[model samples]
Target: MGESSETSSAPETETFLHENQRSFDVSNDAVTHDNKKSGKPAGDSDDDLTPDDILLQLGGCGLFQILLALIIQSMKTVICWGIGGNSFFAYVPKWRCTDVDDVMNISSTVSPLTTMAINVTDTTNTTAYWNQQCQLPNGTHCSNFEFESSMHTLVSEFDLVCSQSWVTATITSVQMVGMMVGSFVVGHLADMFGRKKPFVLSMAIICLSTIICYFSVHWIMFATARFFFGIGASFFMSIYCILQGEHMLSKWRSTTISFPSWALELNLFSLVVFLLHDWEHVTLIMAFLAAIYLLTWFFIPESFRWLVARNKIKEARLVVNQMAKWNKRPVVNFERMVRSVEKSLSGDEDAKYSVIVLFRKRPLLRLTVPLMLSWLTLGVIGYGVGFGVKEFSGNFYLNLFLFALASIPFKLISIYLQVRIGRKFTSIIAYIVCLVGGLVVTLVQYIDTPYRGGLTTGFALMATAGVGAAWGPMQTMTVELYPTVARNTAFGFLSVLARLGAVIGPQFVYLEVLVPGLLYIMIALLSFISIMCIISLPETNHRMLVDRLVDDLDRERKQEKDHMDSH
Candidate 1:
């Protein structure tokens, strides 16, 4: 009878939203049941429902959200696979003058066996052996460079080598510009409208862009198509990553966050290089992947957390109940479930966040600059290694395969460490490895040893592994560090902003002609800067995923305000 009386003494309630779970502590002040007939479970102001708690009650996050994250992440990553595709296609293959003597305007029979060698009489004026005299008594250099007929590439077809080579870099940079624009466009829409619409539209746009890219008759045409491709690709990751990650339970969140990389992209790059052997065909394969995502509507729904943040109370409650049912768990009262989420008094809950806020917000300003630069530098490290792979010893395909192979173990280690050591430490070690590994790759050039090929490839692989390992932690850090209200908006804004590095990454290959060591030097510097930035970010390891407008930072400030007022 004493226990019954204790239970009866508690504040009036119908049922706990989650089975076998206690509701948040409520005030003991007697409350009138004015709305009791209306069937709403009223609660004290402290009552807050968290998604983590809701999912825990559901017994599982359910298969639907898992499949949603997997399909979207895996499919969108195909676009990421293609980012390095430019390396193989933009590579300026070895060339020899077609009419060497006639082009030099020399009067003589062209010797079929003309010997050629490099002339570096002046280090600054060094020229290729054949280029020493385009017309070797009968052959001369011309504006047109004739590459070997067996190998095919965009540089070979468009003749973007020599003086006009900047066009190749222009191609990727313009695409980055497009991505930068698209991230904002799609990100705003996703935050305002819903996740599914923008995701589906972006996939469709990707398919259209791929098809148009295949039919390009001129470089400008290809560039225009690539710009649209960038738009589609940027939108895909910016919106989709946040959409998918938000749906995940925290345990699976790490895997979902990191799932975009590993060996998946490099493997695709190797396969495209070896089998497709044609840029046009590779674009078509990307089209097919985009088409597959159109089926996502049948399976995916708005994230429950997103809905709640948006105040779609009815929908959020419905999804949670459905999730519970799907997980073979009991249902909870919608009113009680939602009331358990804490409210924010700092910022207007309905006010929209923009990209500028990333820099303006005091908590975010410090993180924004360093993390964005890291994004840029990591891109250079990743794609720079890709373009320079040919400079390494061994067969081209073999070296590319080995680089891809090296990432698997490091990526696994990264996944394990991000949870144990935390995101900051994981990113710090990865960037440090990148710095050391990049220096090793460049050091191989100065060593002048026969083992240069093995050494260069090995260290290049190290940089590649470090880049791969950093991706998951960086992604998770991005998602978890920001509040849910601004998460997707921030992602969209940052995706494009950081991708500025990704845009320039492939272009580092252009430096191969000027000074090969310069590219590695640039990479090493970027890695060091990124490591410092990682050091500055708040460690987010094992923290409860923020699912509402209530920020711990804001709460602490409020508590300090209350204490001061007591004086």
Candidate 2:
């Protein structure tokens, strides 16, 4: 539609325009040359147009955006297995020392606790009674173990218990490390290259790593495979959000965050794991599910926002025209619109901004620091409650299913609240809900009622739902707060820090052994901090997206100059 230019401008003086607050219909003429409403001359002031202005003119939530969102959300569903499936993989069954059971002549069905108490006062089997509580009758540590269930899991396969329990916990930690690394590495790749290639590559990694997990011969091998699986999962999760957010209008962005796909997958995962019972089969099934997404490489397109940010206007035009065609509206003077967007750009055609640039800019730094803390706190509590599902005194499968089910309504509620009150307040409200749930979970431990276990599980479920609700609003903020050039990089960096929280989360279970309710107490503290972070952030509910770094920098300087002049 328009010729390309190689001229570059410094990012220091450029500014962005707010999207025109106008909506068009599918059949409306797309030229929009009139200057009556905006008060800017038609061709002369075209440079004031934002991407949102272009989107509204082209029918924002058209068939193309809908199809793209569906494809990306399907990919999100596939990766959810890797995000929370480790709990099932390393499921610890009821077990006791085989030597102690044999020496004490206790029934194999008798639990270790009952065995110890049954023989406490008996004069006979004195050494065996002590052994039931500690070592074997011969004063030697039990070498062999017996499990109640015949199902195959990491615990049953590798005997990861007692002295080896640390291995299970470390498996989860190592996976978080891999996700942390992937958040940075894959994110950089997407921001550097287009979003399509890295997206397909991540799907391949997930499929291959999950197969490796299925065929693992040793505990270390399985753990190593899970680490790679985590990386791929993080890649898909991060990019999909960016892809979906960039393609659709802000109004529809929060609609699909946790419902239909994410939470449904979790509920399905519980049912699948309960039915399969074997870790190998579970991994194989998940791998097969992930492999299906690799075929999407042919169907999916690169994000138009990413293309524009990288100064590929010619490619951006192709996407824009296609969007218009699919929505049944054709641009009359497409070249003029393209030139407007082109003239609006201030950066060098080849110039690129790295994640490091975010810290150097004062305005971005203010947003970045608080967002990092919020994501980190979410990681700690969101994943901590997930990993501790087994520790609750209930049917593990039912507990998992119910936990996921609770998120469905809460996510819907979050969508309503965020739209009404604004993104910042919605996130703060969700975090406050989680904080209250955490406090209840921690306080319930001291209650001596017979229903204390039920109370604990119920409140933990509430906390998880609250954390789940916060994700939609928080992710919407992440997408809206930064320029497209640095959006993926900033998101990746935040996720890397958040993975640190995920690593810490699984270890909370171990800490709870030393001190009950420690996990929820930490969740309560972190949720309050996240609330404070949300409070400091500006509301992004109706603002247009910034496509260039200069836009933010120039705005920051103008604000400072205005402040000084007011004095």
Ten residues in sequence with the least summed lDDT for candidate 1: 1-10
Top model number, TM-score: 2
lDDT of 1 at 145: 60
Please, what's the RMSD in Å of model 2?
A: 6.9
lDDT of 1 by residue, 289-336 (tens): 888877776767777777866777888877776777666766755566
Where is model 1 more than 4 Å wrong at Cα? 1-48, 101-150, 260-262, 341-349, 548-567
Task: Compose the digit string of candidate 2's lDDT tens values, residues 1-567.
Answer: 121122224433433422232222112233233454575523234444556666766676888888887788777766777777777767787666767666767667888787656644363334433233326777877768755454577888888887788898899898899999899887678888878888888889999998998788888998899899889978876787788788766666767553447788889989988887877787777788778888998878788888876768778888887888888876635566566456656554455567776677667787899999999988998788888887888787888888788888988888887767878998998899899999998888777788889889999989998998998899888987887877888888888888899999999887898888999999999999999888988876654566666524335434533433343
Candidate 2, residue 341: how far the Cα is off, in Å: 3.4
Candidate 2 clashes between residue pairs 3 or more apart in a chain or in different chains: none
Error of 1 at 18 (Å): 18
